[model samples]
Target: MNVADKNLARVGSDELAANSPDTRTRHGKLVSPVITLAHGGGGKAMRDLIDDVFIEAFSNPTLNTLEDQARFQLSDLARYGDRLAMTTDSYVIDPIFFPGGDIGKLAICGTVNDLAVGGATPLYLTCAMIIEEGMQVSTLRQIVKSMADTAKAAGVFIVTGDTKVVGRSSCDKIFINTAGIGVIHQDFKLGADKAQDGDHILVNGYLGDHGAAILNARGDMHLTSPIESDCAPLHELIQTLLTAAPNTRFIRDATRGGIASVLNEIAAASKCAIEIHETKTPIRQEVKGFCEILGLDPLYLANEGKLVAVVPANESQAALSAMRDHPLGKYSADIGSVLPGGRAGRVHMQTSFGGKRIVDMLVGEQLPRIC
Candidate 1:
């Protein structure tokens, strides 16, 4: 079997230990069949759990200190920029593991994206886990390793964290909280209110994949198709857009409330009218079918990898070219524009049928338990 398949099966069988250091007994392969309250009782079990599962996977000089806080020299921070950017988020997605990623990956990317949307250079992260009593130790190990792997790939460090365990049903299998730290150059400026008249709106890639993937993974509808969560880190893509379109006004990652919600916020904040064309929105064929069958609007669906960018009309082509060149933004498109001579604080989409309708704030989440 492939390495990924083997790791996925390791939670039920121990044979994969031959090729995996994570399966070794010293790294949290405990004698107990499942985790218990004692794992969080502040004793030897807790220490062993932290040392084996977390410290082993996220080994770094800063975290290795094992102190209450992580310290950095002011000079070290100044190397990247004159200002600092910070963001915190919690992931409580049900069924921690999904088609394209898990809660661990989501936690890391979600935290990093929050900072990156503002043109920050991501650097460090803090992971806090809340685990349930009956969770499998092997499963927890897999999750922690996923977090570590994602953080390393995103050029950030999981420097410190805390852990807690509760009753069997007190929480889901696991919940992760993360805080991200990054540096912002003094020249870079972006905000929700920065959008201006005649600005063009752009998206990194296809939207609504995460929500559809999570709903299908749950098997509540007794239906299935090849839909996977579009979970990814987009700091690199944002940097590329900023380089090409230095006059870009604002950027926002489309997450829980989806692109529709983000556009509404931008319009309201900028006090302008925004218009998007349905023909220009990039969406997968599978996602289109999934939404059509469920009477759902893809515009309001959640997305983990998509982002909205507002760029000036003169620089729109340059920004789109830069985004298309990036791996994460292979499907980038200019979908809309801020209307001129209007500050209605409204967002509307020009329909494929040649009409328009107001796209307002999502009153409530269409999908719950989504990161």
Candidate 2:
């Protein structure tokens, strides 16, 4: 089967497992219904908790060994790629559960995307959680199940993890930190500073759904919409793009600071200017309406599943085609291009109303703890 077909098959299996009543029932019986301080005391209570909740859910030959550190065979890793890419990220978004995903899903996809954008095939992840005392065990189980399902769909393993509990008010209900390892083929080279003049700028799909969905889910705005977080794993999508446009300059997931921040960083690093058309940028109608109501610019909003790629102008169509063929990038668009020298370290956007304006890095946080 083709790459997309294989990816879809895995996703389908993951969804079945995620939605199965048997899976939920099994997880429910693994631990106490509510977590207490003893679970983190590093004693018998901790051992039982680990075995029942984490180990039971994330079972694999490597993790089953339960070593302090996971060991992989060098020969096994060498077959995949020569270089290893490592990334770490923390997820603490409010309302733990959001429209499209939860903290668990965010932790997995965020780390995987970090590796994928660097031309790496993500391989393994380390999950570390800090749970507030008195948190519901069912909540933890659900999050762990989500993580396991995501890892399975992405073809990665959760090889190691740690759990800690703090005072009831010491932290949010829970916080998750994930570190990922990936393998980059020796033939590929990618970097932010590699952007050059005449390169085309592309985004995988609609932007800012995660930010808008989270804000709405919080209910503080007293507004509601069908917007959902665009959380997803993009390793397969990246692989497809790389196969189509081997000379692509750089790829970055539009995460915390959105595409605007990523573009500004690229411009500064490559000492080049970028020009994008506002009309070309894709934003969901719901997200656009939500942002408009709040007087917020969607360009500055965060995206969980979206990515910005800089590719040679000659390969722009090929790259766009590859993205459009992928499930995660159906709304992909060619947003802009890198300008020739003379306007170094600047980003300009052509307004929908036929005006041009500079797009700069955000002065301050527009949304806090947005993951």
Best by lDDT: 2
For 36-110, candidate 1 gives per-residue lDDT tens digits of 898888878887888878988987667766778777766666756678999999999977899999999999999
Q: Which residue pairs of candidate 1 clash?
A: none
Tens digits of per-residue lDDT, candidate 2, 1-371, equal 23664465345433422332221222223356788998999977787888888978887666666667777666655655688899999999998999899999999999999998998778789999999999998898899999999988888878788899999899999999999987777767999999988999999889999999999999988775788899999988888898889898999999888899999999999999999999999988888889889999898999999999999999999989988998998999999999986488899999999999999998899999999
Off by over 4 Å in 2: 1-31
Whole-model lDDT values for every prediction:
0.84, 0.86
Candidate 2 versus truth, CA RMSD in Å, comes to 4.9
Model 2 TM-score relative to the real fold? 0.92
Candidate 1: count of backbone clashes, pairs at least 3 residues apart or interchain: 0
Model 1 is weakest, by summed lDDT over 10 consecutive residues, at 11-20
In terms of lDDT, model 1 sits at 0.84
